[model samples]
Every structure is written in structure tokens, then in C-alpha cells.
Target: MVAVGEILLNALFQVLFDRLASPDLFSFVRQLGGGVDSELKKWEKKLRMIQAVLRDAEEKQLTDEAVKMWLDDL
Candidate 1:
């Protein structure tokens, strides 16, 4: 169950990053010209939040795996 949750979380993070990296979206945003618009600002906030969650998940995964391995070695 825990592993499945981790897999889903990783997949979600990948999809989010891929969407953020889309060239067409970046080009559209660039065309807007100077100063961040509300929509862009909202997206930036959401992206930051997603990034933070991903970072936390990664840290937790590493810690969990280390503990699991240590226990298995016991």
C-alpha cells in the first residue's frame, strides 16, 4: 500500500513537471510581455507548491527506504 502511494505520487510529480516544461505554454506566456499576469502568478504559486511536495516526498522516500533496508539487514 505504501509503495503504491509512492509510485502514484512520483507519477503525479513527473506529469506536473512535464506540463510545466511544455514549450508551447512557455511561448504563450512569453508573448504576454512584461509583468506577471494573474493567471501566470497563480500557476507559479501552484508550481512552487507542487515542487515543495515533490521534494518532501523524495526525502521521505529516501528515509523510508534506508530504514527498510536497515531493518531487513537486522
Candidate 2:
């Protein structure tokens, strides 16, 4: 029951996170001329990978106590 709630919350948070780093937002950031957009693109790639891992982990967490603990620490 608790894990279901936690997963739901995490899914919601993931939606917010995915939006914040969207390509359109990054394009806008690039137009602003910070030169940081390139780095942000790099980060977006890494973050995308992390997101994928997290999604898998979140699913795994229901059956793995250690996975749940790891996510809680994050």
C-alpha cells in the first residue's frame, strides 16, 4: 500500500521533471545566449538516462526492499 503511494508520487514528480528539461525549453534557453545551453543539453542526456534507470528501479522497488530504501534516500 505504502509502495503504491510512493510510486504514484514519484511518477508525478517524474512528469514535472520531464517537462522542465524539454527540448522546447532548451531551445528557448539557447536563444537566451548563455552558452550554458550546450551543457544543459549534455545534462539532459545524462538525466534522461537517469530517468530511465529510475523508472526501472521504481518498478523493481515493489519487490525489492533495498531498492525502496535507495529511492527513499534520494
Candidate 3:
């Protein structure tokens, strides 16, 4: 299945290309897509890190607030 963000980005690219004749617009879209993908990857990594930290904390009998604070520190 295609991701929603990818679909939206494709639509945006098509619209931009259709309305604008400048080659710079294509470059801008490519850069925007790269930045969006980069941020998504970072978020997924952070989420996994947080989940691992929470699991370790559960094993050690740490409180929920402590787990949250640890994630916040990250």
C-alpha cells in the first residue's frame, strides 16, 4: 500500500509542475520530498528507541513518568 504522505507529495509535485514552468520548481519539490522523508525516518527511529526504553524500564519496574522523562531527554 502506498503511504498517505507519499500520495500527498506526489499530488503536490504534479500540481507544482503543472502550474510552474521553471526548472527550479522541480528542484524545490525534490528537496522538499527529501526533507520530508528524512524527518519521517528520524521520527520512526525515535519512536523505536522510545519503545525500547519503555520495555527496558518495564523490566526494571520503572514508573511511566520516568520513561516519559527519559524520552523527553532524548
Candidate 4:
């Protein structure tokens, strides 16, 4: 059986893919001046979530003692 961590990671990856593959994503982004503010806002939110996940994963793999100490506050 697959581990829970693997399952959760897969789920998160799926979410990232779905957000990036949104049908009107690029078009909406390109038309930045044409009332695409809402789409851009949504995109920013998703990007933030993706960044957070990536940051967490990277921190977990750190061998630098100082970096791990800094991540402790997060």
C-alpha cells in the first residue's frame, strides 16, 4: 500500500496541475487590461499555494543547520 505522505503529495501535485491547466488561464492572463483582474487574482492565490508547498518540501530536504533553525519558525 502507498504511504499517506505519498498520497498527499500526489493530491497536491494534482491540484497544482489543475490550477495551471485552467482553460482560460493564459488568455485571461494575456488580456490583463481587459477586466482580467479577477482571473489574475485567482492565479496569484494558486501560485502562492504552490510556492508554499515547494518551500516546505525544500526546507525538509535541507542539511544546513542554520536553515533548519530558520524553518522552525515557519
Candidate 5:
């Protein structure tokens, strides 16, 4: 009974997670070498935080205008 929007969001989340762990991305980041690794780590941390917030917002957006707006802004 999931809505299409929810399905698309889940798919997007999976794609993001996949890209984050991708070996090609890791190899390229390593090649970049001048603090790129650190930058990637920082982004990984931020993405995790965002993912958590996204899940919370997904559940809240149904009834909360502010949350819906926040999710939409994403």
C-alpha cells in the first residue's frame, strides 16, 4: 500500500547508499589524494545524518506541514 513517492524515495536512498560505497568512487577519491579522502569521510558522515533525518521526515510529513516542506526542499 505504499505510495509511489515513498517508493521513489526508497529507491533514491538505495542509490545514494550504493554510490557512497562504490569501489570506483573510492579508487578515484584515493587518486585525488590531497585531502580528498578526508572530504569523502566528512560527506559520508553527513549523508548518514541526512538519511536519519530523511527517515524521520518521511514518517512525519503526512501530518506536519513543516516536515513536509523540509522533505520537499530535499
Candidate 6:
């Protein structure tokens, strides 16, 4: 009984390790821009837009409450 349990446990670990090391798993992650360079490029455009909005708000001082609220909603 103990030997059978040990065999099952070893088989379970082997299967788990095989799945974790599979290329398909890595390919799926890469498709979602898991790479550092790809992830940064993905957010670059949004970051630029945010920076521009902040600069504009600072320069204009946003005296209008309605406009300020609209920007805040964003």
C-alpha cells in the first residue's frame, strides 16, 4: 500500500512538472505580451496620453469645476 502511494505521488509530481515546463504554456504567456519589452511598448501610448493630460491641466489650472470633474471621471 505504501509503495503504491509513493508511485502515485511521484507520477503526480512528474505530470505537474511536465505541464509547468511545457512550451505551450510559455507560448500562451508570450502571446499576452509577457516579455518585458512588449509589455512596456503596450503601455507607452497610454502613458504618453496621461502625461500630456497632466501637463495641460497644470498649465491651464482647470478653473472650470465642470471640466475638472469630467477629467476626474476619466
In the range 27-55, model 5's lDDT, one tens digit per residue, is 99999899988988888888878778878
lDDT of each: 0.64, 0.75, 0.52, 0.62, 0.80, 0.54
Candidate 1 — worst ten consecutive residues by lDDT sum?
65-74
| Residue-by-residue lDDT tens digits, candidate 3, 1-74 | 33354446446545644544456654665678847545555655665565555446544434466654544443
User: TM per model?
Assistant: 0.47, 0.57, 0.40, 0.39, 0.65, 0.39
Error of 2 at 21 (Å): 5.3
lDDT tens digits, residues 1-74, model 1? Answer: 24555567667767876776678877887788775445666876787786686556556656687644543342
As a TM-score, model 5 comes out at: 0.65
Better of 4 and 5 by lDDT: 5
Residue 35, candidate 5: alpha-carbon lDDT: 97
User: Between the candidate structures 1 and 2, which one is better when assessed by lDDT?
Assistant: 2
- Identify the superior model by TM-score, candidate 5 or candidate 6: 5
Candidate 3 stretches with Cα past 4 Å from truth are 1-34, 62-74
Over 4 Å off in model 4, which ranges?
33-74
Q: In angstroms, give how far residue 60 of model 4 lies from its true place.
A: 22
Top lDDT model: 5
Q: What range of 10 consecutive residues in model 5 has the weakest lDDT sum?
A: 1-10
For model 2, how many clashes? Answer: 0
Return the TM-score for candidate 2, rounded to 2 decimals: 0.57
Q: In candidate 3, which residue pairs get closer than 3 Å at backbone N, Cα or C atoms, i.e. clash?
A: none
- Candidate 4 lDDT over 1-74, as tens digits, reads 33455457657767776766676776666676775767667766877786676566555646666645544433
Number of the candidate with higher TM-score, 3 or 5: 5
The per-residue C-alpha lDDT of model 3 at residue 28 equals 64
| Decreasing TM-score order of the candidates | 5, 2, 1, 3, 4, 6
